[model samples]
Target: MATDDEDKVLLAVCDVIKGSTLLKAGRSGKPHFRQFKLSNDLSRLMWESAKKMDAAVLISQITEIKTGQVTPVFLKNPIPQCEAVSFSLLYSDRSLDIVCKDKKEFDTWTTALKALIVDKYDNKEAVSAKLVEMRGSIVSEDRLEVQLGTIKTKVLLKDNSCDLYLWGGGDRGRLGHKDDKPRFLPNVVESLLGQNVTMIACGGSHTIALNSKGQVFSWGAGPQGCLGHGNLRDRYSPLMIDGPLRDVNVVHVACYENHSAVISEDGNLYTWGKAGPFLGYMDDSVTKQTKPRLVDALYGTRIVQVACGRSHTLVIDEEGRVYSFGINKFGELGQGHDKAITKPTMVPNLVSICKVSCGRHHSAAIDEDGVLFMWGWGARGQLGQGEPKSLFSPTPVNGFNDQPLEDVSCGYGHTAAITANGVAYCWGDNASSQCGVPSSVYGELSSPRGIVLPSGIRPTQINCGANFTVLVTSIGQLFTWGCNMSGQLGNGEAKKTFSQPMPVESLSEKRVKMVACGEDHIGCLVGHGWVPDEEVKSCMACKKSFTAIRRRHHCRQCGGIFCGSCSTKRYPLLDKGHADPVRVCDKCYVSLSSSSNIK
Candidate 1:
């Protein structure tokens, strides 16, 4: 991502700075100058003199990179009495302020520190890239990788043997049937049979798919070659993406309205389509990458995941740090400034962001601790901050102290989330009844409200689309509400709108493992060549409801849904047409234990 000279400067940031003053409130500490060195592996930042090791903080321990004096000590001492070019390092519990010798040195130290936090770039590249510092006056830089709402596929599901299904608007070749006819119900994509497709991303008009072999396929109406077929022509059948993606194992793919990107298993990122700055391209001559091209700027970084809004894109690295690029007019980048940039700039102050979702303008991310944060456009209260106000930085959604959220989805103007306990909440624009609330309830919600679901409808995954919502239960049931203009609800209707959650009866026959939402279309991935999730709706013996945490188990012997208590034992049954654990049910466990043929 940087030249050798810049890498050296970033790796060799040896400096002495005036420290102190900026501790937590009610703490006492004196200011002093100390020499500091970044560890060779760039894992730790250590400071000391010739005699003693003052302190050593893991680079990952620093939660935020801040600028200027902000502590009570600095309030009393004032900037006139201290170094004006100073920055602060905020950890989980404490903060350390360091003052540099001059403006150049201050920029160098701050840039190096921010880049090292994301584990990329150096001071010069950071400056050129415009770092995302929290301070209002300071600028931020970028490293590019982005995921779109089209493919905000969570990693919670690892099963890859899934069949592809599609419904809704077939215009622009979205249904992948080589025709522009609408599918009013869930129908299997016969062409994708036996492909073992693991994931699917439904974009505004195009669709991208990835199979178990790491092959990526795309079709539908592509803007600026988003389909990656070397031209802007729309495709009706899934075509394996080649060009720069040829022979590359694409682990992840994201698509919004007009752009698309993918992360290779080897940690390399490739992007196509049209996103002026958000596309993370260094070249200024090319307006659109008609073919998928490797993003040279973020070449070596390990991007774990990505999400994209209408025009902006956010990428998360292996360290769980957040980075953003593209348009920031509404502060979707969470860089504390609205200026758009072309590189992947670190989103400061956010720690261990594990999941991210992008709406038409807003963005949401969940930390490892399960706290949900929202930023960007909030004119419709999509930020869920109890008010319609845009946030330049990531802000935690209140009222979730007890139960953390496990899944989140952002739509054109609405948002949805699922708690760890299976509770679903919706907030933001309800004008089209997309917020899971009837139009009588209000045009928009300022805060999240529990969605009134039908009996036995506990959601394990929640997804939002242009003007509709999709929820998947533990048993593979799918319920939809809001806009059905294109028969996206999969209920054999095209002109109706739903204010309450309605089951897509056509999908009740199979087990839905994953779902993707496009502007007016839908894509589903179901468990293939196995017992459908629908068959395991309840425990065969107890008949209890299944939730996100209280999962339904399958009996290895009879293949019936059983509670954990019923299938507590595992026994080999290779002789009975099974290889691994053939008899796990209570009866099978007891019988296998008594059988001398168990060998």
Candidate 2:
């Protein structure tokens, strides 16, 4: 039931001490019982249904818990005091009303759930204090009070903020530095030193950043007005998008190719740039937008997340319903038919979807039950269907039904996912090793393959570039592999490709919070600050003198360097210190394929 993502510490309670069966109260009141279970990581509560009605909700999604006496479920079908017990799990827009067998069962469920709010969060400190004895009535609106007792302790968690960094191809200012210069290693976006950037998104060449104040900033190539500045000019530094978005409080942002979209705290969606029909415009006259405009067609529904593909856009609301729009020539919109929809339209069949991702032409989604569903382009096997056929509608991607996944990512033509146990599975186009597997061994990965990462550190987040992939671990370190022709790998070298995840040694001291990748550039939001490793003199491995021809190389195995060679030919006696992959070499030859023993 727990996701293998170790950094989150979600599975504080691993074992299901109580039975999985629970009675769920329905609005219509017919089938009042269902099989219920909790994911191992304590991230979600799932309803195990044999049919298509299976549903789930993240434990973090639950806003509050209320005792049965105060909920409307008891008023609709009042249960006598001698009959049973009930408690309602309230969300932002709905409530999950359930009935328990007895007070013991009620106490067990309530205590375990309350523990999540306190223990699951990172950097938490529990404080014990006595509750004020109340003989009188309490506000029932947002209260959780069981007959057994009131709360005795509370946990206060620290909030961490990340500073922004950028590197790789700096063409047209895509890297956001004041000067358009290709940074081979991690470089701080000095202008945004105090921006407190919470999220970032990358397009074909431009980039977008979201700060804690909910304001939006963008920079890079603005041709077709992709920068949202009301002009088609490129910028060499981060520029805040004001105008129409000045007063809007954006909570999330997504961009791809030549377009961008942002969702406000109120669940309203806004879009800009050359998105065509995917902008949620009702008419064909709206070819592109220079400034942010609200998608009026989706006025009533609350959109929580948005993803943009090459030819389509995907979104999911608070109700777990999926929607698609834009060009559907390759069925990238997830619509049953291969026709483009000019506005927001719900994708038929998918329900309780918690997350979604988009590649150049394909798309991926995860439902509440931790089930993966894919659609759109599959010609290169990005859909993980074990075939190259395109799926016009949403279809379940079978593999991790038992150990549910908490997150997934889509590269230009490849896909990757992380399981409940923190293991990474990848598939799709591998011509450039974008799938994290050896391209020579498997030119095309149709089915998902679990990749082995360095022991100890588990993957917390992952992202895909056009021909590369980057992963962030719980301890704030980063690993990048695949095409580095434009230095997108951030390993201090260009024109190299690696199948195994290699550490970006330059930023080892920075706790990487998130990574954003464009077709050629890369951006990272890291917690706090760090300095690059000190410059080395003689090669630590060979203890050789300074010379131009004997170019120094760092070993990937030992942080000494990114071992210049992904080979096992055995060089001169090795060096142990961190440097550019000198003769000591990269010890990190771990492969994504489980059966391989190549060093």
The candidate maximizing TM-score is 2
The TM-score of candidate 2 is: 0.64
Weakest ten-residue segment in model 2 by summed lDDT: 126-135
lDDT of 1 at 33: 38
Candidate 1 structure quality by residue, lDDT tens digits, 1-599: 66766644533343211121111212343333344556544567776433565667887888787777785555554333223465678887777666543344565677667776655533443433332231342312221221222322111122465888899998888788778899998877755654668888888888899986678999898656788888888898888887777678788888888788888876788878874787888556677678888877787788989787778888889989888888899999999999987888889998898999999889999999889999999999988999999999999997554688999999998899999888999999998899877777689998998888887778999899998999999999999999888999999988867888988897777789999999999998987654447745676556677777667776554445567866787753322222223436675566445432211
Candidate 2 regions exceeding 4 Å error are 1-160, 530-599
Candidate 2: C-alpha RMSD to true structure equals 20.2
Q: Judge candidate 2 against the unseen true structure and give its global Cα lDDT, from 0 to 1.
A: 0.71
Instruction: Report lDDT (CA) for all predictions.
Output: 0.74, 0.71
What is the per-residue lDDT of model 2 for residues 145-209, given as tens digits with 9 covering 90 to 100?
11212312111111334678899988889888866778889877755654568999998889999
Provide the lowest-lDDT 10-residue window in model 1: 16-25
